[model samples]
Target: MKKNVFYVLMLFFVFTACNREDMQNNPGNIEVVQKDPLTAKEINEKINETIKTKGRFSWKESSDHFIWSTIFQGNKIASIGFGSSFDRNLDSNNKAIEAEILKVIEQYEGKTERILLSSDQYLNQIDVAIEKQETVIALRKMKNIRYLEPADYRYFENEQKLGKSSSGSSGCGFESTALSASDYTTVTPNAKAPWSFTKHNIINAWSYSSGAGVTIGVIDSGVSPEQTLLGSSFNNGLSSGRTISKNGVYVDSIWPWSTGYDGPNDQCGHGTSMASAAAAPRNNQGQPVGVAYNSNLVTYRAASNVVLDGYHEQNGVKIAFTELGNNNNVKIISMSMGHIFSVGKIEDGVKYAYSKGKLIFCAGGTSTSFTNFVGVIFPAWMSETQAITGVKENTSNQKCDVCHSGAEIDFTYQMERASGNSIPVLSYYNGQTDYVGGSSVATASTAGIAALVWSKNPTWTRDQVLNKMRQSATYYPTPNSDYGYGNINVLQAVQ
Candidate 1:
């Protein structure tokens, strides 16, 4: 009878050990209590609530489980940020983290096959499929994992599908307008200088430096091929000895695994105006001239629209920043595109470029159809970039009707005209001009002015150039609560 009892005890212990191993390996079988997925309305409401309570919303501050349930609706894919935040030298360490994450994923999903959708070569970020909620819980507990956000959550697209009104600030246009004589002054070679040029003293600044030696990298929609001045005729008339290159990093697909890249061409009209506002060639075609007419140009088609509302758009921006950061010739990086809240990969990309000593400029928020309650907006709100917004003519304190302003605004541009016009830029098509307004043109024009300053003081560090600009601005030594240093006097900045 004692021997029989010993055999039964051994069987019981063996069965318990087997059950424990199975539970550890297969977390899906451990009876997880799942919550209902949040609706679009609920998600937006939560975001507003958070913003009201915290004064701002950041994915980094939110819990990993909430991010999965709300933004992603328990979507299978998640963006993983590992290693130290903004650590440029964590490449090898990141690889190790990637391995560990994959191991954890395998333990939960019970599959060893490749699950990583995409991994950034430079930034310590990866996109992977997490089948079980337990996996998210476990990953959050890991010391090396910094953040886990939905990799493919597209807020604007989802909103549209749900029959919401289109965001008023899509920043997509193709129409070209005629230049009114009252809006411009005739310059040499029959070129037209925008009236705002005189308001900011950019014409006077030209005598000092036309951004001849500096290269400005535009991270926006690509320049139009039909606009010859930005292309084969880039060196026409007085704008000589400068090169313009076009690149495309935007993927046309929503799938994270899509490898096809849309070519370097501006599908949206916003990019063309931005490029024209910054560095359109000074030519004899009776066209509107740019701020840095003689500056070298490098434009990237990084997104479908100025509103970064989709997965591919965000990914494209990340790729553009990294590539521009690696480029030795790029001195200033300008992006008039942004999101209402911070994106982890984009933050990483901006930090990478900033670390490479590239002077960056981003647009302050512009009023959108959905909401305008946001302040400076992501990337611009970050300290690494100089945020610019549009202001009414001759008034630094008053912002344009559609432009957003806050304490984060670094500078204001005289973009809005008394006649209800904005800055005149070369149209997407050749031999045409268009009016672009809000903070988009403001940011680009400011970038052009920076190019001029950097060109004049070629040996100056980024800080030196920035300091000079601040000192030369309308409000120096002290900043306004709404606008930082206020309007920049281009001539004074270049000098």
Candidate 2:
């Protein structure tokens, strides 16, 4: 009888020990243990549990954005809006239910921090919490980092209308007078060609020529054949003094859009303007010039019909990659097209280019929305944090390069209105080129600078180039939402 009693006592002790361990860990009641913010470790645990329950899911984490890209079983999207959205869907499995419950608890009572957990985990946690009669989930959860949103730039529109003239005005900041075509031989301070001046005078320690020695493939509606200012140099071989393509591919393009491919023709004037800012030939006697004029260029006709709001965005990317892939000279790419509410696929394309050691400069966006005054556009939103620097003012009233300053844009450039919604083109385009402006123009200008830097070093990595640009930028005071970093200074970059 005593032996039997001792055996029962041993069983009781084991049960008590197991209970104590459970209380200590408290995995079931995650709220009791979740005292800290949802760190990556917690997020991973939730993801694992979700995968086990849902049977399959693909997930990846970006250190840059601190978000997760997840694909559920059978390629199904268990989350709504693809990424960082309020709405989400999850599998109805046990583990999924558990994960959902945990997610809800963390979101509700744990921290304001956003933790991108797998769909299954999130759903399971929610389900479990519901069963336990504990229901609380915050609808708004975002990362702790600063994000560019649509409503962020509403003040810019007001500022523009306020009639405050900024110094970075068109043809003012970091610019020389237009080159005199007749005095090509007589090199003056502003008379010297754009490339020569930048090479000898501007560039000493820094470079704005990443596209230098690179073939920048421009896929637009079409390049003008006869136009002398834009892609015409590619055909005439006058600027670089070398044939654009050895096989004559650039000289002769027979694509479906070939009929519209007027290399320098700017019918819409948008592409031509973008191109000029990107890689206009260096004028021996002109004002400050394009960021990279000596760089190789490849032109493609991707704009199908503007009236129908149709653009060959996918085709443009495909052609750029296909043609530029094998070419050793293709180092940087600049794009000025995008739409809001996109799925960020274009950013994926940019990342692919970056992985290949190619630098990409994309436009931020413009305020075309008839409703909201402030908003963000694609391509610009995809850049690394330090990619762009806002133009600012120095104490001497000159332009300074700074990051996240809103005050220095008083002198920023804007096209002068000639009449009702139209302006004159100082240079040329594929079709009746005219003047235009937008964040797209700013983005293209930066790309040109990147090309210049690339031309100088040839050995610097993409990150190194980006850092050099940021580090070299002159900061502005009273930064706001408009100018991200500060004004871009090519001379500062070179010096």
Candidate 3:
């Protein structure tokens, strides 16, 4: 018995020493931490110190051990309460204590070390945890975890909605096509690709003069690899080449998803169109440039389609894209498709990118789709934290303002309205055809601009780029709901 007691005491001392060392490394800095060690028996004492400390979170000892509850002030972690165990039998008040503990835990709950391993790394461990029902969600409810932001709360709501709206299927069956007139202009000698530089001034201009020697990622309906315009887009500033697409989440893997029908096969033309805007080569031998003409292109096909009313079936696409964004090399992601219903947890992907210092550009809603001016669209909506809302106009005398009418404006760009009198470019879909217009094109334009901005200031953070766009916008044009912030001037952004 005496020996056992000695063992416990030694362990207590060892634990205390470790805690002291941890404090040195991470002082929690809310208050002044003196030279004191924390013992297993004295964890309560540490909680008391936390409470009295000047930091945001405070803590105290409770009747039971091994459990802790936190207090907060206006979403800030204010204090914590510690206990011996989470077992209800051990501490009759465990139920109440657990509830309070859950709050504190949520605040600090981010990607944990246990879950940080590679996708295959600890797959079994994750599976085992899943079998035991030990979810990150449940962990979040524990007093031991960290906090959840308001954004996180919103994500949680969106996640629940996913269960109701999602059908377990990939968005396949996209009718493939070559870049036609609708996709690009004839700039080069025989360029038929939608994103040819010679035809479209802004996009084509960006190709040669913009995105030079830069790398960009397109997360959209799959793009065709062999298109003349895109063939050499990813090539090192030379005339023509290719970037190998390796499947998986790591950066080294060129492409994140499997070579779906969309892979190098932009069936819907959305992916190919966006790519053209970002980096179509100037085969015209003139200055029809892209923002990053010399830049490299990386593609990730995440969203797949299914038969859902008015839904574009892009959740899987966004999720897959998020996984790829984990790679540090993928700095910018351009998504031009999304669903109208706000998927809350979808923002989690955006948050992950934000944490990794990645910039995400997604298309705003299409005008023909809906009139509900509130609630952002997927990826764009999910990226409430870092999204650049798209605004467009056909007329030349145009300007946007997102500040005074911050409710709507994020940024604006020019759009070529489809002429009713002329034959619209034919884009076929599931045996039916409809003319695609509105925010989709606008989004493609903004994405191209973003590529240019990134190429000019490769060092800027997503926030920095966003602020520059917001502050530098010629706002006096009187912001409108449609044209949030004014037009995106690549030259101005670079300056």
lDDT of each: 0.85, 0.38, 0.40
lDDT order, best first, reads 1, 3, 2
Top TM-score hit: 1
Task: Write candidate 1's Cα lDDT for 1-495 as tens digits.
Answer: 999999999999998888763454456555456555567666766776787677688776766556756535524677788887655475557777788878887887778765787888888888787666677766766778877877777666665666654755588888988878999999887889999999999999999999999999999988888988889998879999999999999998766667888989999988888999999888788899999999999899999889786678888999999999999999999999998778888988999999999999999978876656777888898999999999999899899988989989999999998899998888888877899999999999999999999999999999998999999898997988888899999999987
Query: lDDT value for candidate 1?
Result: 0.85
Error at 344, model 1, angstroms: 0.3
- Model 3, range 86-124, lDDT digits (tens) per residue? 122344554454444443233334223331211111011
Q: For candidate 3, which ten residues in a row score worst on lDDT?
A: 122-131
In candidate 1, how many clashes are counted? 1
Clashes of 3: 67
Q: lDDT value for candidate 2?
A: 0.38
Window of ten residues with lowest summed lDDT in model 1: 21-30
Q: Candidate 2: worst 10 consecutive residues by lDDT? A: 68-77
Question: Can you give the TM-score per candidate against the true fold?
Answer: 0.92, 0.47, 0.51
Between candidates 2 and 3, name the one with more favorable TM-score. Answer: 3
